[model samples]
Target: MTDFSEQDLSGSSFDRVDLSGSTFRGVDLSGAVIREVDLSNSRIRAAYFDGVRMHGVEIPDLEISGEVVRLVVNGIDVVPFVEAELNRRMPERALMSPTDVAGFWEAFGTMDRLWGETTDLARTLPPEKLHEQVDGEWSYIETLRHLGFAHACWIGGVVLAQKSPWHPLDLPWDEAPVHEGVPWVRRIKPDLHEVMDLRRQRRATVAEVLDGITDKGLGRRVTSATPFLTDATDLTVADCLRVVLNEEFQHRLYAERDLRALGAG
Candidate 1:
């Protein structure tokens, strides 16, 4: 029940240990064998991972948030360390099968990392930068606002439907909320550091809210309701979740472009 962080546990053989919720910051997890390990809801930041040995480890989806050191796949240099970790852990399971859950976990890692990068850019940027317009289009703040609204409209609605007796049938895209006044995209510029911290915190919450989903919950039907629909329909939880990730991918692409145009190029 003790927090073991930033300690030199090198040449240490950690086995059958409650490493869950214990951070391995700047610790080498290379070839560290773990039997029945539970890394659920743990954060690995600034950790040096040559590769850790895991057996029957219950790793509940990792959310990334910055520069990763290395990820060797069969001794090949892969992109992100967290992505490589998920790929390593991908297997076959029933409740939220290994494949589907792995996909979301991988994306969650990437999403966290991207939020870090983009939020860093936003923080360094002044209001003049975010407020800059393109072709009479939305400013960067407006763009983020749009992304936030879409997240709520799509993910929020679907998540609620899954929890309620009546599941969501469709997204009310037309009546979706607008993006403006977001702390990161506020009318008045904020302290760049605060912006970065707030953005990271917000993104983490959003990702966690979606990551807690189980396979059973996903396969079940959720009554979907939309303003455009005369009646709601039952939608598979997986389908609803897909809508959230798909929207995220698309919106990220747009946000990236707009931010790049605003001098983060």
Candidate 2:
């Protein structure tokens, strides 16, 4: 394996390069254009494909799992189909899209219980392993920090109309822009218990919001001036809360999978 770290290969063109079976860990391919490529039998995991435009592409047997939104297939958006199928597979998923106050609280309570179980599993592993990344994915501690950041973004910033609600330990998404007041420090290796304490505090904030939720509040729209969000000018209160729930549920699954891998290792 060749180490090409910190090398500038910009504007370099490869006509018939053989990169088959090559590994691309922590490589940035932003703003790169590919005319023709064969990705048959290729596997992609924990990748971000935001704002990517493709034409004349053939996709078959493609499996995607993550937060998929506004995905258009053949000029038709298939997000609803994907969401409905997912809800059918897991009936509890329907609770994530509740329309009433009681339903929202019930969904939150269910997620809280599920997360508790996952956290208990993490507690069995060595404290240092919680900071280790598995298969190029976020570490267990980073996942918790990201979840706290999600709560601060959705619940505190959007719903509660706070300009900046990020904690010092909160970690934002990788593609998020560098904001003035938001915490984007990825180098700080925080202790596992410290991250969990912050996570518990953020969960409590969500619980407070859920407790105060009403039918009218669910339908109401919230607008905020948070520096972290660029396009979240207008959003429904329920939608913002739902984003937090979705992040919590998805990251819990990711953390569980990584914890199992760590245990087996």
Candidate 3:
């Protein structure tokens, strides 16, 4: 339940203290000694961890979705584990609630509502902060496109098509997908204005597509890895659309977060 992220945790120690679902964005925790940390759902993105120490730290299923993460302790570099995961986590987390689609709607609705407050921040943020670094750098605008491409290509094309009614229509993003599961390699980074326009259009249009679906579409195996298979053994078409909504809204929320960082929100 603790929310303080940047405080001096150098001498602090805890057991059974849940730091999950907490976001420590751009905070300085370089000198902290994190012990027995349950960072299961913690968002440790781009925080300074130069000299941080780890002892008895259990990081099972850790998802380091940060821009830059250099884990060096005692002046020795510890290689962060990497795997070709379908996703870093289970896809069926959408089923965590009574209504499968509620989470997606909640996240996207707030994004749409708040984006108007910070639309100007995109212009104010420095090019370096927004679009300088190769890996870490991404503008508020580009991030949205990156997300839309993933949704329209991978999740929508592969996951939804495999489970739901296969339309097999021509895509604006790619030719026939490379394989049955993966979207064909197509650099879908359209021009900025065009990208944004299409994104908005897709958002509006996907609702109709989603409305005509049912829960059985989730019956097919859609994820790129295991663990999720355990939970997603079957899915309804409606659940599949809900999953798409959930995925899209997650990116929208991420875009809103970056937007607010520039004091736009």
Candidate 4:
């Protein structure tokens, strides 16, 4: 066994080296060349792949999920096409990127109504099924918990400028880095009702903020007390709300998909 920490292995060359099951954390590989590598069954979390070019790659049964700024495939940038298709499938998604106070409120209202319906569907399932994870995704309960966290971070913490808005059961993303004074309890199994209570409180906070929002307020810059955004500048109120809207919209779809997979929908 070997270990390398805080050591610069720049320009290091290896041939026929077997480093299977090895761990690389906080390592720099910005310009490293990888060839003929077998990355089957490998997991990459919170990674950056800017300007990465892959040719002659076999990616059958591969799943990639994240923000897509631009993805070029065979000389075609498909991000716009994908966005257009998504907007066609989910008409309300086009509203998620609203540019006005009224649009923001409408977006939130649509999300609230949709979530209400989804939660109602969830209630018909067995109590234990709500805790079950389908395809290794977040369980029903955990999805709600993560939504609460999103609300707290973007709405309560950033928009309202609160120092601490996290609830005890609020769950951050699975790959989120640990930060002081933020809740990230993945093992806690609160009943659906308890989580719904938290959801109501979080939703109320958004409502209150939206009630007083102005068109000018949407463009007003705000900073967050959350560690992750402490150094973020020029974050507008509208930007924060849009993040919550996207999170809510995407996570609800994920929850609904998982619920059908569990045969509980």
Candidate 5:
């Protein structure tokens, strides 16, 4: 059981090496070439795969969950097909990608309505249950907190040019990088009302932004001063709002699923 850490193993070659059950953390595999590698029952998390290509691979019973774009598999880009099927199933999923002001309004409206229903359903659960994690997922309260963080980052920080727009209870995603002056506390057990008030405030801010948005406004580029997103200058106002919408919609679905497992909803 040899251990390697913080070592520059660049330009190294290991042919016919047995590395089953090896742990790789903060390891860079960029520009590495390999053939006949077995990754069965292997778990890769918080990793980036860009401009990668594979050939003559046997991939079955494999499940990938994350942001995917331009993923060519077997001479077919499956992203559009996956998106079409998701839109067909969820219907409102189509609204997340809006092309006009009306569509944006509708998309946000749908999110507001659905989140309203979800929070109402959450209120029916035991107060302590709201803070309990299901299947290693975020608790209901944490979901709301993360959504608030999303709104603050995309809308307040980027569009409104706020240097620091994070609430004390704001919760970033699990894989988010540590940033100074940003709240990422996970052990604080905030009550439902406390978190709900924060959510209402954030939602109102988004609503106000939507109220005066024009098609031209949507196309205007926006940048963030937050250290995590300082390089996101290519984003437009519409792109930022769509990110918030996607986070809200997906997290609500996860909350609902966890709520059902908690014997509520």
Candidate 6:
């Protein structure tokens, strides 16, 4: 293995170079244009591909799974179709889009039970391994912290009208703007139990909101304004709560995948 730390390789070109099975860790490949590149059988994980434009590419049997914002294929947006197919496969996904208070409670209860199982699986692994990032994804502790941040932003700030509800350990999305008073400390290596305690507190806050929800209240608008959110405009209470539920559901899946990888390692 070659170590090229702190070395500048600008304007370098490799033609017919054999780089198969080479690992690129913490390497910067931004703003570099490639032409006629053969990326067959390549495996990419937890990498950013924002604002990328590809043309004349022959892609067969490609499978992508992540948070896709806008994916246009053949001059058509397929995000809705993809989402519908996913919801069809997992009928329980419909619970996340509940229109009434009773449905919301049921959805929350389901998520609570599912998260309990996920946490139990994580507990079977070594404590130190829980902090390890699998395939460059967020560590188990970081995932829990991010979930707490989602609850703080959506449930506490938006629904309850709190100006700043973020905790010091709350982890924001990578592309989220720097908002004053919002926590974004990525280097804070917290213990698994410590972060789980914070998560329990946030979950209790959600429970409080769920217990007091009414059908009329679900349709009510969230008037709280926070810089953490992309838009400051008012949103329906149902929409805000749905966002929180989706975060919990999806992040648990990611955490479980990483836990399995850690156990195998």
- The TM-score between candidate 1 and the true structure equals 0.45
Off by over 4 Å in 2: 1-35, 40-61, 69-85
Span of 10 residues, lowest total lDDT, candidate 1 = 163-172
Question: Over the stretch 60-166, how does candidate 1's per-residue lDDT look in tens digits?
Answer: 56455433456444566566655556446632111122226556666656656665676677656665677676655556555555444444444444545422211
Candidates' lDDT values, in order? 0.50, 0.82, 0.46, 0.87, 0.87, 0.83
Candidate 6, 86-132: lDDT as tens digits: 89987777788788888888998899888888888988987888889
Q: TM-score per candidate, in order?
A: 0.45, 0.77, 0.41, 0.89, 0.90, 0.74
Candidate 6 similarity to native, TM-score: 0.74
Cα lDDT of candidate 1 equals: 0.50
Poorly placed runs, candidate 6 (over 4 Å)? 1-56, 68-81
The clash count of every prediction, one per candidate, is: 10, 0, 12, 0, 0, 0
RMSD values for the candidates in order, in angstroms, are 20.5, 4.5, 15.1, 2.4, 2.1, 5.3
lDDT of 4 by residue, 128-226 (tens): 999999878899999999999999988888888888898999998776788887766779899999999999999899889878988888898885557
**Model 3: lDDT of residue 238:** 42
**Residue 47 in model 3: shift from native, Å?**
18
Candidate 5 ranges beyond 4 A from true positions? 1-3, 15-18
Model 3, C-alpha of 243: deviation from truth (Å):
4.2
Q: Clashing pairs in model 4?
A: none
- lDDT per residue as tens, model 2, 1-265: 5667777888788788878887776667888898888888787765779999999998878877877878998899999998889789867778887788888889888888888888888889888888899977899889998998888988888888876688989888775677776766877889878987997888788778877778898878776746766567677888888888888877887889999999923
For model 2 the local lDDT of residue 42 reads 82
The ten-residue window of minimal lDDT in model 4 covers: 224-233
Candidate 2 local lDDT, residue 217 = 81
Which candidate model has the greater TM-score, 3 or 4? 4
Q: Could you tell me the lDDT of residue 205 within candidate 6?
A: 89
